[model samples]
Target: MLTPQQPLGSGFGAATTTDEVMTGIDLSGKTAIVTGGYSGLGRETARVLRAAGARVIVPARDLSRAREALAGMDVEIAPMDLLDPTSIDAFAASFLESTPALHILVNSAAIMAVPELTRDARGYEYQFATNHLGHFQLTTRLLPTLRNANGARVVSVSSIGHRYSPVFLDDPHFEHRQYIPLAGYGQSKTANILFAVALDQREKAHGVRAFSLHPGAIADTGLGKYIPLEHRVAAGVIDEQGKPVRDPARQLKTIGQGAATQVWCATSQQLNSLGGVYCENVDVAPVMKEQPEKIDMADAMRLTGVVPYAIDPASADDLWELSERLLNW
Candidate 1:
């Protein structure tokens, strides 16, 4: 059965840090793959997991930059560009050849609202292509390795930005409708959630479960580098001085805090029996059935729960089919 979108009262909150959430957990002998794990919350997560004795592999587009950022850490770096389908396939094939099992897969890489419309080789929007489609292909390719692990968890690092818009199924590539940056981003994020829901339904009986989560509004993660300073300030993520505002209550978070939920979902014993749920604040989030009336970014940030449409099972199945068709798989 699908897990309900209700908080588990895990006693962890928005202020929980990666170290805190990982307390008393030992990941020794386990293996994990974290995409975009060179920087931002992804990097922090990789660091924490490696410290906990998991063999962490980070796939990066820029090997030099990844090595520099990951220096002094024991984590391994592999070359793979999310935008390139062939690169993803190559990476998956190489990983499966060397690794017998993958205990955890964290789809932590993503791009935020790009000011301009960008498309991949397939002509899909950049945000959707990178954040959703790329991970979708990677996970499907790595399914054998994941299933090999007796129990494995797939964590999707989605965002509250999903509230900005549901997936534009009718015109996902924005061919018919005018493209808006945030809407494109929102569409991808919603896909992240729906992908988890659908994946869990199919994989849970095989001991592989999936989850999606909001990492809160972390301005230092570089995911928002494409968004302008004024817009961030307006969104209350940063101040006029260009410094990140730390307010866990309002969803703004430090890097450690922002990385907590994904880590929790990946390692928490409490979640062993649960999957296909949307989580925030280091706990399963409740469903917000009513969509707010065209709220601005600031207001959207204050919104606390997952939107109903993002977790709809029927939508999840539809998205899975659409993703397969798009990837030509």
Candidate 2:
């Protein structure tokens, strides 16, 4: 199994910013696909990437609203619904039709901690299917673009929730007993890290690298708006002031700060020579050996060190196969 490949003290700690980390780097002439890049940390990511000279493509589900939000921003707005496989295919096809090489792909679009068990059109559970499986299919379908890049990187935005549970290989769709939203969601998030590990191992031979990120908790960005209010309070993300405490753990980052790690992962020179680790803020997280008290322990475990589940190549391959079957890819 792959271990925490972190060089001793490799990370620059957790408070790095997109612009600060991206200093002296120029992404000129590169094409980047940032899902949900028009809102929240995604929007901030898009802004930074564009600032560094990469052409940014913000594929969003709600084009009108996304465009309105992204108005006057130097980004290309495209339509993509993660819940719809057909939409995923159409977006891929359309992009490939443009005859371009892809240098960066950030799967930052996700829904967190919802109330119920809902399924997409293909009968796949909503959270798992959209957050992990959709990106899986999208990545696979865009393999050609990824392969053609100079040195492409696929960055998946995973939360600290992977500790909720490892991949439930037995019943990924909750067919066996019950569908707990958080558990199923954890399974999907774990799959995200595994996907990066496995994909990097395979794609490094082709000059393509894959990575996963945890952007920290920023409820105001509408990142976790899908999670009901009660859950937010229960999660301790909200305070009596009806606001995020800015210190998710005594010093939490703002929305811009939350987006920093992801953008850094996507465009930082510090990571130019590395690939296939989970990062938070601007630094790659250290191995989290214990369960966190209130924050996302699962995510910390995955990012900080090599969680056994994420390092298992067989498990990742298994997940890939399961995703293929579910998506009918």
Candidate 3:
């Protein structure tokens, strides 16, 4: 696989904040849509974007909570649930009716290490359905509005857990395999990267750029809420002390740190000529080349090279076709 990940020295690092990333940048009159903006990194992102002068719109499943989350902030909350096609359509349609230009979109919502085998209305495995497909349809539906803006950016919040596994193409919906939650989460994370690949390929020509990001680990993030405590113990992610174990698995970034990379990808002039790359902690990620068990990140800095099963163009096409059919788009 080709290694496409290269750092351009943007000067932002793991410690950078969203505000630092956007310093001196002006987003006035530009519109941004942040999914899951009511909590965690999403809320931090909205805060920085608003501070930087952008008009922020949050598409949240819970309107009441969203309002409270951003009270007194210059933000708008719209009702949209990724798993529900009607909700996504209604929200997108309502937003587009008022404007043709959209500048920034952050697909910053997801579940991690969920406990049960849940499915969406159309029976899509919940992880893949919500984390990947929902964002897929949302972005596709809003493509025209974004393209009209020129230089628009789309950010997909993925996870390093993508390293756990790729999309099992033949059994993507877990029809045959035993249901393992982390594996399901991994598939969805992998899809987030591939979605950016497909999206940037198609939309860059229209002046819209797409990026995928791994927002670090479980520091007070919603993703952790779904993780089973028993599993966490066995994995040594948490010890008898009920605190995170000292390992890469348990290490997490602060919410502000977690929001840095996507914000950087959104506004940094250093990335001015780049698109279609996966980033983490404010920089391009190295390509991963090894099979899940054998590959070390250093040996595989292929950020653009998601696992073959993950980035398979054929599978991507198949998934897109299925999503459109499911959403009735």
Clashing residue pairs, backbone N/CA/C < 3 A, model 2: 160-299, 163-298, 247-252, 248-252, 261-281, 286-304, 287-304, 287-305
lDDT of 2 by residue, 1-329 (tens): 24355543535545556666667879999999998787888888888888889899988889889889888878899889988889989999999999569999999888766667777777777778888988988888888988999688899988777777788877777778687777877788888988888788778878788888777767688756666676666556776666875663432567777877777777766677578788765667665656554445223322344345654678878877777777665
Top candidate on TM-score is: 1
Per-candidate TM-scores read 0.99, 0.90, 0.88
lDDT of 2 at 309: 65
RMSD of 2: 2.9
Local accuracy of candidate 3 as per-residue lDDT tens digits, 1-329: 22256656667666677778887999888899999888998898888888888889999898898899889887999889998888988998998899889999999988876778888777889998899888988999898899999899999988776776777766778889888887898889988887877777777889888788876654466667676667556555556666754332223456777788888877777776577778876887665565656433222222233355555556656666665665677
What C-alpha lDDT does candidate 3 achieve relative to the native structure? 0.77
Q: Where does model 3 exceed 4 Å of error?
A: 1-3, 230-251, 294-315
Better of 1 and 3 by TM-score: 1
Estimate every model's Cα lDDT from 0 to 1: 0.94, 0.76, 0.77
Query: Model 2, which residues run further than 4 Å from truth?
Result: 1-3, 7-11, 226-231, 248-251, 290-306
RMSD in Å for all candidates: 0.8, 2.9, 3.7
**Residue 179 of model 3, lDDT score:** 86
lDDT-sorted candidate list, best first: 1, 3, 2
